[model samples]
Each structure stands twice: as C-alpha cells, then as structure tokens.
Target chain A: MVALSPDLTGLRTPALRRFLTPGLVALLVLASLWSLSSGAAGLGPGQLLAALTGDGLSARDEVVLYQIRLPRLAMGIAVGAALAVSGALLQGLFRNPLADPGIVGVGAGAGLGAVLAIVLGGLLPAGVLAVTGSHLVPLAAAFGGWVTTLLLYRIATAGGQTRVTTLLLAGIALAALAGAATGVLVYLADDRQLRDLTFWGMGSLAGATWGKLAAALPLIALVLLMMPFLARALNTLALGEAQAAHMGIDVQRMKRRAILSAAAATGAAVAVSGGIGFVGIVVPHLLRQADGPDHRRLLPRAALLGAALLVLADLLSRSIVAPAELPIGIITALLGAPVFLWILLSQPSAARG
Target chain B: MLQIDDLKVTLGGRDILHGISLQVRPGEVVAICGPNGAGKSTLLRAALGEVPAQGRVTLNGQDLRQGKPQALARLRAVLPQDTQAAFPFTVAEIVAMGQDAGDFAPEPGLVRRALAEVGLDHLADASIQTLSGGERQRAHLARALAQVWQPVGPQGARWLFLDEPVASLDLGHQLFVMRLMRRYADAGGGVVAVMHDLNLTAMFADRIAFVIGGRIAACGPPDAVLDPGLLERAYGCRIAMNTAPASGPWFVPQAAQAG
Candidate 1:
C-alpha cells in the first residue's frame, strides 16, 4: 500500500542555502580583517583601515601592508581553497570520506617533486633551466602528484571497485617511498638549500611572496574553476561508478578529470605552502555536517570556509608566540586533529564509508 | 524496436556471452531468465550498451553506442542491481536526482509521483542508507522511473532496462514491480529485465528468454519457452510446468529425489 508521498521538491535546504553561503562569506571577511589588523606591528582597526586606504600611511607601514601581509593573505586564501577542494574531489573520486591528499600520499608526492626540482634543477642544461625558470618546481610537483594519484588509483581499484583497506595500505607504502626520496634530496642539498627545505617542510606562509604566490595561483585557480563543473558528476559518483555511468555521466572521463584537478590543486598548494595538513580534511567535513554533502554547494562553500579557516590559523601561527612565529602546519594540525577525532568517534560507519 | 544482432561479450580473456541475439519491441515486456552464471545480466548490459560487445544493438534504429550518454539517457533509464550511496542522501534527494537529471524539464511533481508509485512517499525524508533492502530497491526503481517518466518522449519511445528490479521485494511488492514494468510497456515504452522468478516472468512478460551457459536455450512466448524438459536441462533439475486455472504457464523446481 503506497502512501501518498507528496512534493519532495522541498528537499533543497532553501533556508540553509540562503544563509550558509553568505554566512561563510561574512566569516571570511571577518577573519581577513581581524588577521590584517592584529600582528607583530599591532595595527588597530582604524590604523589598518587608514593603512589600507593609503591615507597618512608611513613608508614602513606601506611595506608591511603591501609587501608582507597582503601576499601572505592571498597565498593563505589560495592554498586553503585548493587544499580543501582537492580533499573534496579526492573523497568523491575514491567514494570515501577519509580520502585526503595528505593521508593518501599525494601531498608527500608533491613535496618530493618540489624538492627534486630544487635539487636537480642544477643538473639540467642551462637552456632547459632557462625555459623552466621560476615555474619548474610547482610544475614538477603537480606532475608528481598526478603520477602518485594514478598509481594509488591503479593499485586500489579492480573490476571497477575500490577497496578502502587496500587504498589506505598502499597510501602508507607510497608515503614512505616519497619520504625516502625526499630524504635523499635533503641529504644532497647544500647548506642554504637545506635550510630552505627545512623551513618549507614545516609548512609556513612566511615564504609567501608575490612571485611565489603568482607561480601557484594559476594552477590553483584553474582547478577551483573546474570544481563547479565537477559537482554534478561527483554527486552522481556517490552512487558507485557504474551507477553514475547509468545516470549518463562519462564515468572514466570524469574520473580522469577529478584526479587531474585534485592533483593540480594539491601540488600547487603544497609547493607554495609546504605540507599544510587538515584544512583539506577538516573544512569539507565541517561543511558536510553543517548542511549535507552536495558538491554543488560544498565546493564553493568549501572555498570560502577553507580560506577563512586557514587565514585564522595563519593568524594564530604568527600571533600565539608573538613575532617568533609557529609553522602554520602546526596550527592546522593542533586545531584539526581533535575535530577529526570527534568526527571519527561520532559516526564510525560514515567514517568507514 | 530494440534490436541486438549476434551480441558477443568477453571479459578477462573468457567468454561471458556467446553470440546472443534478440529483438524487443515497444509495447511489450521481455524477461531474460536463467540460472546463475548463465549470462542473463550480461545480455541485459550488452543491450543497454553498458558493456563492450562485438555486435550491433540499435534502439529505434539508432546504434546504441553512437549516441552520447546524455542522448541515450534521455531515451532509456536503467536500474542497476546494487548501488551504494557513499554519502547519506535522503530519499527525496535521491529521487530528485533522476527527476531533473541532465536538466530535462521534469513533469510536474514527477518525483513525488514516483515515490508514491513505489509506496515510499512516507519515507521521502529518510536517508537511503537507512532503508531496508526491498525499500532501497524500490527507491532506485522510482529514480529510474522518474528519469524517463514519460513512456513516449520527444525521442519517440523511452525505455526501462531493469536488472533484478524486484529481487529484494516481498511477493506482493514483486508483483507490484512486475505490473509497473508491464504498465510502462503497455503505455508504448519497452521493458527488458533480467529476472530470477520464472513464475512472475511468466505472468508479466509477453516474451521470455532462457539463457543457459552464455547462450540462449529458448526464447519465445511463456508457454513455448516454459517447457519441462528445456527448463530441466537449462537449470539442471526436475521442473514441473503446471497449467493454472486461467493464467499462462508457470513452473516450480521439484526436489532432487521427488522426480
């Protein structure tokens, strides 16, 4: 006996959608403003506003605002968005909530690639180095992430199904492999290069310069732009691959595009910011709990929420110890790990999925 | 008409379907039946163009492979055997996925209409992962039905290709699903299903196909294909084909020692 199930068109969270995006936007705005105002220099809101407008702003303040903070802020926004979106995309592709770039070895692969380019760029011919120039490291990192993703995908999937246990185990192996390779590069590097690598490895936004941000932004922006188009396909993918295909998705092509975009995003972010963990894993989970996992909403909202979270984390990294500065990675992990534990503990089945 | 010309499929260097060919016309329900490993599902997939095969499959004279997925989906909807939603998605959300798929203009209230058709209207707000197996099966059927809500679309005749659509349902629900397929066929759409229940297939199908060991052993009207000797050989057991009072031929497998 069928009950008269009426109008399900009401499913779209109308009240939630209306408020969530703007709420995230406002949060990002507040975080950015708060971050810009409080720092080692400690510019108050009015002074920061004055400095921003270039009204009665001193040359020292000008350099601090324009040369120092702006680039870091921009880099934080870009890297944060890229990491979170990459996590969302990877999770969708793998069809598991826990498929993060950092956990799955893709971020380590990207880091290895960046280190390789730095250490091995010296070995390349003068002409080749000239052609690659500033772009070499980030490009190599993206390629490395792409290759690692392909390898993991190949190992974990058979007969159009992915075994989660295999994926996690292979990720552990691949992460070790990448770490070993990175260690070898560190051993080969000279003192100056070694110092750079050490600081970079800790994952700081302090190295955020206009030139470096420029190098990473194009790739990050490209993938962010690609996410909206992927939303429908990713939603369909939540229902297994064959079922997604039956729903008229070009499943194989969608898989390739998702991997490629995720790789590019993660590689670009890691190359510039150095192994920032948990924003990718944390931001999406928070949003999913906030509403639900509809990628159309999730992807864009992820961009805003991720940017806000990272900017706040960056603020804490710089401020918590006052001027000496902690690595942004530390702040993210410290904040992210406990939340992640809560998620794992609360819904063991959803986590397993 | 949906036509299959000598369809053959091989997977992992082994043959799964061997030169199978069949024709299905609009306005009729056809069932593909066989024991386990008989390639019944494979044949259905081949016709749906879900698997690679070395033959021609044409629906309404258009090569199934030539059409883009969007184009093909506009003409037919398939309900796969089992699909897991990786995320927690509500029933209404799942049904709406099909109702407005690929940006097609949905018929007014078709998603609710579909949920009602399957008696899932009461649980429209419930998550799909929370439903029972039969409930999930009917939910998917509703999604498939919503996708091609109109039996006749601008593409002429839309179709429903169901793989064990009622395999998880109770007897009453099984009969309900079969009747739903029959009604779709009668309304000028085609229905091709891989079925497990021979009695239900006999009752609902205009034509029945018996696949045995990657080949079609018999395919004809229910009475013709429901032969005792053929069923026994195809299924490797004793089968009793009995004539009910006023219905088509139906059969039940006899015990190994009973003869």
Candidate 2:
C-alpha cells in the first residue's frame, strides 16, 4: 500500500517523523521509570524520582537505587539498543527481513564462550578465576562472536558476492553448533558453576555494574553513530549487489563494515546481558511496520523501541512472580514470538518473500 | 567516444564471449542483437566491469584497462534486465542513489525531469517495491539518467549500457524506453543496448551487431546485418523480413512443417 503524503506546509513542516521521535522518547522515559520502581523494593514513582535526583531518600534506599536498580536499568537499555541496531544492520545487509544477530549465531557463540570460561574457571586458581573481577570472560565471548561472524561471512559469500539464503543457512548451522557446545559445557559443570551459568543463560541485568556498563557504552555509542550514515548505502544495496556497485557503493566494503559493526555490537550486548533473545529480531520489524523502511529513521526508532521493550520485559519478569522472578529470556520469547507471528501473518503473500 | 577492442570473457571454465570488438561514437545508439545464450548480456556486463574480461575499453581515448571502480561508475551507468523492487526506497531516493559516487551534486529538478521523461513523476514518493515491472524499469532508467555526468576535463562522453532494457515491458513502455535511449544518444550521449526484439533494434539502433555462439558474426547498419542469411544462420529458424513504412525491417519467425 502506498503511504499518504503528509502536509508539508506550516506547522507540519517536519511532518510525521517529528511526532514519532518525541513519542518514542516519552515511552522510553516511562518504561525506564517502571523498570526501576516496580521491583522487590517497590519504591513509588516519587521516591524513585527522588532517589534518581538525590533529593529525599534514606541511606539504604540510596544504596539500592544507585548500586542496584540504576545499573540494571542502564544495562537493559544499552544492551537492548545495541541488539536492535545490530539487527537492523544485518537485515539491511542480507536484504532479508527475518535476519537478526541471534539467528546468525552471534549470540549463541558469545553464550558458548562465556559458558566455556565458567567451566574452565574451576581448573584455574581462585585468584585468576574471580568471576566478577576479571574481564577474561567477556574477552573470550567477544572473540567467539567475531570468529563465528567471520565463518558465516565466508560461507555466505561466493563468486565475490553474498546470498541471503546461504548466509541464513550458515548462520543456522553455526548457531546449532554453538548451542551443542553450550549444552556440553552445561552438562559438565559442577554445582556452583552450573548455578552461575544457568542464571547468566537465563539473561539477567542483575550483574550490571559501573565497570560492565563502562565496557559496553563506548561500543554501543560508536555503532549508533556510524550506522545511520550507512542507511542510504544499505537502501541502495537492497536493490542487489550489481545495482549497488553501479551506484558506486563498493558493495563488498559496505558489507564488511556492516557485518563487523553488527558482530561487535552483538558481542558487547551478549557480554553484558547474557543471551537476551528476540529483541533484535522483533524490534526492527515493528519499527519498520510503524515508520516504513527508511533505515535512517528505522535504525533510531528500533533502538528506542528495543530499549522500551526490554525495560517492559524486565518489569514483567520481576513482578509476575512477586517474590520469585521469571527469566527475562523466557519473558521475551513468550511476548516477542507472538508479535512476530502476527506481523508475518498480517503481511500479504506477495510481500512475505 | 567509446571503443571496445578484442573483448573476451570466460566464466566457470567456459568462454562466454570471444574476441568481440565494436565502437560507438557520441550520439550513436549501438544495439547488440542475438538469440538466447548468444553472449549479449555477457558483453554488456563486461563493458560495465561487472564481469572479468580481457580487452581494452577506451572512453574518449583514456585507457579503461584496470579502471578504478569509482572512475568507471562516474563514466558509465548500466540498467540490467530483470530488476526487482527488492527494497522499500522511495522513487526519489532510488534515483538519488545514481549520484552517490560522482563529484557533481545531483539536482532534485533533474530527478523530477528524468522521472517525467519516463512518465513516472507522479509516483516519485511511492515505495519502489509497489511498482509494476514496467514502472520499475522506468525507475531504473531514471536512475541511469541521474548518473549521467559531463566530464569536467572535456575528455569523455557519458555512456549508458543497457542489457535487455525493454524486455517484458508492454508495447508502449517498450517504445518509450527505446525512444528515451534514442533521445539520450541524440543529446551526445553514447548508448550500447542488448535487445532481444529485432524489430525494435531495426527501428532505433544506429548500428546492429549480431552475435552467434559467443562471437560477433556481423556488425553494420540494420539493413546490412539483418538479412535472411544471417537470421537463418544465427537463429536456425526464421522466415521473412518486411520493410516498415517509416521504421525498418520486421522479422517473422516461421514454423517448419513436419515432413
């Protein structure tokens, strides 16, 4: 269906795009507050605001707010945004709407690496294996993510070009391999290591700290800053490699940069949050439906929508069981899958392929 | 302004184009006509550097051997057959992509004018994916038009390489695209198009090249190159040619009677 043109004169000069940004920003603000205030401590909105502003709160409340909820909320937002942006980039690169970092094995690869680190930690000295103190696990996870990305890239490319079907197939194969590796590590873990691995695999923001946030923030910021400039190039590329080359895109260079950025962002997110699923795949599709498929707009909108979705998911994960918490990954899968199915079913048959 | 010398292309251990040579001056429309698998598309791809080939291609006397991608893109634009609206770009955005590599800033008015030339201006804001095949072809032509550059040093003429530019188009759109190419040539641009429709080639091509089995069998004006002998030899099944009142010859394929 054709989009109706917005009136471009007078007050609507910036048009529908202006309205969407503020609306999404407001939703994100509300979701962030809900994430912070709706947990076990259950501070009211006013107290939450007071704790945030350092206005009127006791020492215990201050510690809980600053040391716990704030970091968790920040991690949720950053990881969610990173995953969504990476998904948008991959979808553009593959020219397939179904593409996501998780589907491409980046998340599973990172998860496998982190599980391996945990399993191997028992063999090392206690001083070297301190889980929270050492950056070794994240480093290993990032390496695993990048290696898997390279493998997928090579398999997908043939005759100096990439094909979407080949890329998807390669991604599925690697994802299965990583999953099997993760399963073996889980099977072999001791009681304590198994507990740690299970909790991490369930996808928590509970481990968020200033140090972890510091590690992830710069990478996310760099990707976000660079990805919008590539929107026009990606749009051209969707026409196919031949046309994109004719348009002077240097299609191979563009694909390399896009894939590298996607891997880095996805790896960083997995390192911080531990295998959060569905946000990457669903957020971009939802935003594309709402705002149409201009990646310039879609990228930023997906970032915001993703952050909001994760914060909302986190809220439900904490509150649905009251004293007991559901795993955030379970919550996202339950919610995101139905929405994704609805979108797919709603599209006409011609548009689906 | 554009010359190809002894061009040869090999792909997948198979030689697809063998020692083909031709030239097109400014304001000339050269149509390469051939049957299926006769290397017409291969020749156009070779010219655009989309496929590897052994040859010398000179644009206004500048050697295009090992030409940098950016330089080639600035000097020529290609429209291949079987274009799909694979993305959701607006028509205007797709057209603007043609100017992405060049030094010249694209004028929006030029985009509108190009779309108008193909009678697609009203759909400029529409999503490209929603267009029909004919409309999408016109949009591609508009994109090529936007890429047309006047060399700053006065050394080269812009060339458009089209492979089956009008295949699968309705009669009107077929005529429209060919006429647009003719007008582009008349404006001092060079055009080398691969066409399957011999009638259209006869009507508009300044010269015709008939290719058979990866080789150019004949190259000359339509009247000289499209005679019965070449037609029967290249196609293996053809009958008669009729001269049109204003255009040129029209070939009718005859069914062989069972013995």
Best by TM-score: 1
In angstroms, the error of model 1 at B240 is 3.2
lDDT of 1: 0.84
Chain A TM-scores, per candidate, are: 0.92, 0.84
Weakest 10 consecutive residues, lDDT, candidate 1 chain A?
A: A1-10
Superposed model 1: Cα runs more than 4 Å off: A1-13, A52-54, A125-131, A338-353, B106-108, B256-259
DockQ of 2: 0.40
Clashing pairs in 1: none
lDDT of each: 0.84, 0.78
lDDT of 1 at A211: 91
lDDT (10s digit) by residue, model 1, range A41-159: 75668889886676887787778777888898999899999999998898888877767898889999999999998888789899988987787778888988999999999998775
Every candidate's chain B TM-score? 0.95, 0.92
